[model samples]
Target: MKLKTALPYVLLLLPLAAFAAPGSQSGEIRFTGQIVNSGCAVARVGALSAAQSRQVEIKPGLKVEVDTDRNACGHQSLPISMSYEALKTSTDKGIVTITYL
Candidate 1:
């Protein structure tokens, strides 16, 4: 009888155990490659956000597709770079593909 009573308590702690682990629940992947000028990469993923590093120069003619949380999406082709310090504080999520030119 005591063993049976403890089962429910054990079950209740499972959720807490999962959260105690360090990692992200958000489904996001980051990929980096050299910018090769003319090819475009498509990332079919979930909610997306982007940040560019200002301290370094991003390859020119880079394009991105930010498919919205909804079925709708947005695209951008620009030149920029992100500072390492800035990247640490960024909340940008989703699939990132870098094409080398």
Candidate 2:
């Protein structure tokens, strides 16, 4: 394909590339604390629900967007790396219990 023809596809991939970068994916937050702190750890003050779940590698100082259960709040940034296994357990109704090591 000509460079001009391929340009569109390349441009479309920029955003995808950004997300794939380590800097973008560095925000894997695993909440490890009391059930009471699940709010702050996950960083949601109120009850939050996860319609869908995923396994991710969380890094330090990265902000995780509260994809689901955002009805309660927005930008509940998690400053920790939540484990892939523990996050799965915390996505239920009421309190979400979690831990990190």
Candidate 3:
């Protein structure tokens, strides 16, 4: 009974405790990997608020479909814009073929 009452508060502080532990120290993490049939990787993912969703703009492009999207989440019809941060120019391209057995 008591544990249940304190559970949420405890859970919140658990991470804080870990951060303050004796061996805890600031650090940086870097990732490097290669992907086939893809030019740019997914930098990050997040949810869009109501205002953010409304400001989405669409552009013309060839349609590439993923047969099964294992990473699909959030509301359908939410707009996502592509930026060419990893590409040399807006005309750069990538070929992504998804296959799963």
The top-ranked prediction according to lDDT is: 2
| Candidate 1 Cα lDDT to native | 0.41
TM-score, ranked from best to worst: 2, 1, 3
TM-scores, all candidates, are 0.23, 0.25, 0.22
Off by over 4 Å in 2: 24-29, 32-101
Superposition TM-score, candidate 2 onto the true structure: 0.25
lDDT of each: 0.41, 0.45, 0.39
Q: How many Å off is the CA of 26 in candidate 3?
A: 13
Q: What is the lDDT, from 0 to 100, of the residue 76 in candidate 1?
A: 46
Off by over 4 Å in 1: 24-101
Candidate 2: pairs in clash = 28-58, 28-59, 29-80, 29-81, 29-82, 30-81, 30-82
RMSD of 1: 16.1
Candidate 1, residues 1-101: lDDT per residue as tens digits? 99999999999999999989878749888679964443332333322343411112223333334332222121343332222222455645323434332
lDDT of 2 by residue, 26-101 (tens): 7786678655333322534233346532233343423233432332222453333454333544643233334432
